[model samples]
Target: MIETSEQGDVAVLTMSRGPVNALDLELLTAFPGALSDVAGAAAVVLTGAGRCFSAGVDLKRIVDGGPSYVAEFLPALSTAMLALFDHPRPVVAAVNGHALAGGCVLAAACDVRVMSGGTIGVTELAAGVPFPTVPMEIMRHAAGSAVDRLVLTAEKLPREEAYRIGLVDELTDDLVPAALARANALAAAPAEVYALAKQQLRAPAHERIAARRERDDPGVAELWSASATQERLRGFLSRLAAR
Candidate 1:
């Protein structure tokens, strides 16, 4: 599900689950281990194969597997996201294409996000699910004032608009190169200092996650498993199929 390569001191981690790189339980479970495997690298660049960074959770899997699956999936989702969010080394998101919902949250977890040509937003609400604590906190930290609009409206903003709203740090046709350069620049800093600063800056979000996750995540999972939410998910999938 993850393809790892080296670019000098920077480790390049690509999400390679084909088609849309949808976040299934396996993919989510594998992600943190991939991050751990790249620990020797000074920095990391996370991108996706094909035209999508990721399209978010696999709704078909959810609909087919029902509550049992959702119960397992929610924790994996939070763990994977938190792994990326809490990685001590500098991590840059090379958003090669569409990053929606969990995918957008994955990108937001990075220290910097560089996009070439794709929409990026949190569309969890549109998918008939509420944001789990990890993603919600990450988005709130990365997106600043735009979080409310992105979360509540569930609009996938185009690259330029995403930049304007602070979701994207840079927009470039040369996505990997730009992202690598940024990662390299960040890696040049004293590792401990950079890590400490990053931790300090992100401390509030982490605190929020710590305080709220235990209380919030179970409720979120229950909602996802609720019949009404499943029905809405089915309707959302039908709409996608029609398109």
Candidate 2:
């Protein structure tokens, strides 16, 4: 589900699940662990292979016996997200296509995001997939004024608008190279200082995510189990298939 390769001081983490790189339990567990194995890298560049960066969480998994998965998966997902967000080295998102909901949050958690040939937003509310605490924080931190528009409307902004709203730091024809260049620049900072600066910079969001961890995860999971959301999830899967 996750593939890692090293290029000099930068580590490239590619999300390679078929069709679109949808987040599932296995990916949730493996992504963060992969980072640990590549701890030597000064910076990490995360991207998805094939067409998309990621469509977001695997709705099939969420709707199929979703409650059980959410019970465990939500925590795991949050842990992985927070781990990437709090990683010692700079993390850059190289988004090649539509990055929605959890995928957008994953990008948001990173130090920088470069995207092209696609849209990006947090569409979880519209998709009937509930948001975990950490991902929500990522959106608020990264999107700012765009949050209300994105969450309430679930609109996937175009590349230019996405950049205008701060959804992405760079919008260019070249994704990985732009992201890697940014990562290389960011990687110049002293590792310890960079880590601490990032922790401090993200402290508010991190605290909120941690604080809401106990309270919000279950509610989100329960909503996933609800008939309405399950029906919505099914619809989402169908739409994805049709596209």
Candidate 3:
């Protein structure tokens, strides 16, 4: 589900899957534990094992479970997302490819985000999915005024455009090394102070997201499972498959 490489006090997390990392239930279950295990790490760098960061949530799983199942799973998912926001250490997202939907949320939740030259956006509109209210709130808090294109449009912004929109901290051909270097620099700070500072930076957003997650998650999950979104998603994927 996740591969962790420990180098001193830094934990490098790689999501292993296909050409694109797909967030199935296994990945979701494994994610919280991975973050927990790296609690004491000076910094955390998150990346994909293959050509992409993550494709998003596994729709097949949702389809198989039927629409009603989303509600049961959402609370855990919300917690998992919030955990990254409230992470003790700085979490850097090293984006290797298009991050759509949940993938974008994952990146947004990180303390900093760096994208490879090949990266793109997997906007929810393009995915034929509505932005879950809770996730949108998380994005607003975590990404600040940046990354609005990801919310309003379904368009996939290439690395350059992502940089222009401030969705990425840096656009580099060598994302892994850049992300690692940044992590190391952050690690140089006093560990206690760095952790506390990072916490303070995100505390307000975290609290707001936590409250909304508890209050709005059920309805958001139900909206995600709505027939309209499902049909649109199915059509979009089918077209891709046909292509």
- Please provide TM-scores, in order, for all candidate models, with all chains considered together: 0.99, 0.95, 0.89
Candidate 3: residue pairs that collide: 100-122
- Score residue 81 of candidate 3 by CA lDDT: 78
What is each predicted model's overall lDDT from 0 to 1? 0.94, 0.85, 0.76
Q: Worst lDDT window (10 residues) for model 3?
A: 68-77
Best by TM-score: 1
User: How does model 2 fare in lDDT?
Assistant: 0.85
In candidate 1, which residue ranges exceed 4 Å CA deviation?
A: none
Better of 1 and 3 by lDDT: 1
How do the residues 1-243 of candidate 3 rate in per-residue lDDT, one tens digit apiece?
689998667799999966677776667777889999988788999988877788787776666666756665565566677777778777899998878778878888887888984555646777666655556776786556764756776666777877777777887788878898888887787878887997787667667766775567666677778888777778777877898
Q: Rank the candidates by TM-score, best first.
A: 1, 2, 3
Judge candidate 3 at residue 90 and give its lDDT.
Answer: 73
Q: Clash number for model 3?
A: 1
On residues 1-243, what C-alpha lDDT tens digit does candidate 2 reach at each position? 889988788999999988789988888899778989888999999999988898888878877866687778888888888888888899999999988888888888888899887888888877877677888887888888878888888888888998887878888897777888999999999999998998898989978877887888878878878888888888877997899
lDDT of 1 at 62: 96
Best by lDDT: 1
- What's model 2's TM-score? 0.95
Ten residues in a row with the worst lDDT in model 1?
Answer: 118-127
